[model samples]
Target: MSALSQLDRGVAPIETGMLPRPFVVRSRREELADCVTLELAALDGEPLAFEAGQFTMLYVHGIGEVAISISGDTAKPDSLIQTVRAVGAVSQAICGLAEGARVGVRGPLGNSWPVERAVGKHLMIVAGGLGLAPVRPIIYWALANRDRLKSVDIVYGTRAPDQILFARQLLGLSAADGVRVGITVDLADQDWSGQVGVVTDLIPSMLRDPDETVAMVCGPEIMMRFSGQALVGAGVPAEETFLSMERNMKCGIGWCGHCQLGPHLICRDGPVFAYPAVRDLMSVWEL
Candidate 1:
């Protein structure tokens, strides 16, 4: 009934240069807790060029499609990286897949975070729980071009200490000059000596120029709502704060009605939106 299904049945395999080729998984690793990192090699041995913050729709045969943000750099186009959390049936299938398995992929889709606009401005990134995956690319980009940006700060929060993703990598970034990093956990373990509180509390201590800084936040809707308020209260402008939204994105393209929120579709217009753009929509329930 779906367009993809119809195409699969009726369309002949044509060598269209524009169509994306199915890539095979070269390796997969279990990262942090309950997360899988997949490294895919293109079937044709060509690299996929994509901007930071763009996502791809990965399709599993006889299963379903899931939108995964591309975690690797565009400069290294030979391989692609996707970090996914095992949270659903489809995701479980992806997590269960082994090396050399074939998976269909389409995209480099959606608008990326405005990295160009972020240049020359102090950047503040706040990520919570699995929200870290979507923002990971931006962090990598900032570090890769450290001299271009003025200052960088990252604040990541998870349910508990064990739930934190990219622990060693974040710690390394924190030690780098001109980059400040902080981690918070809702509940602390015996060994956890760092900050023990909500992520909002850490915002006040980070040195930032409210007028010249841009804050990007990705997390649960409730978390982002409160975080946005906290940033605004700290003198960061409303327009300077951006939030990445999550909804049931049944279709990666705009045709499906599953991800509609107000005048936009999470699959099309967002997944990332400036805070003011979706403020009203976030206020409504089941939107």
Candidate 2:
């Protein structure tokens, strides 16, 4: 997920940019074998107002910090929610935090999806694996503003049926009016009844009007590249389709050059960008 071009949303908390605020873990839910979703409340009683798609740097005491996207409802700013997959030392520490555990938080930072631009236009959200965590905020925003938009289509693909995140919620969303949810897994077992294929295979079916659709896609680099191409091939304007980029970010802000991608910094210029903005760079091998 990314942010708006300008940092004028006033979405950041009251604390200074570089400082971390005290937040207590209010709840934790296990989403997978190594993934957990945590809800945190600020100890100072201040709400971290954030735009959908922005992320935060979560710091576990005696451990370290890692950037994770906000995965809660934007309407509820007082409680911060983030889903963590225990892939690294810092992330594992975050995933292991128990209820009432205290942690340091910096941000609610970076750009957001240009959701307002999708108003009066059909919106499509696509995600793969944990990419859903970053793009989940947009789904919440779209559902809240359903009347303002034409339609909402969500296409998600993961490795297996057991790997699905927010399964019950996704089931309920499929029944919501004006919303279409299509889920697929790369492989399936005897108990699975859903489609089995890459996410792109389901894209054309969910799209109502290709030219009038605005898409937001987040996944691995190759998946996003193909998705962008598919959207353009189906008649959506390249500029109207956005993809979130990820890199090895040391500093959530752009101070460190670890996240540089050619001329752009993944942490600053984007984590989200229109397809045209990153199309060429994405084609390069490990640039």
The TM-score obtained by model 1 is 0.91
Superposition error at 6 for model 1 (Å): 14
Residue 213 deviation, candidate 1, in Å?
Answer: 0.5
Candidate 1, 1-287: lDDT as tens digits:
64556556765332211134589999998886678989998898878888777788888888887888887766777888888888897888888779999887777777778776678988899989888888888887888878988899998888998888877777777554668999999999999999999889898787388878788898888889888888878888888888888777765667677888898888779877888899888889877
lDDT of 2 by residue, 98-190 (tens): 999999999888899999989999999999989999998999899889999998999999999999998888768854567899999999999
Give the Å error, residue 23, model 2.
Answer: 0.7
Best model per lDDT: 2
Q: What is the lDDT of residue 104 in candidate 1?
A: 79
> lDDT value for candidate 2?
0.89
TM-score of 2: 0.93
Clashes of 2: 5
TM-score per candidate, chains pooled: 0.91, 0.93
Worst 10 residues of 1 by lDDT: 11-20
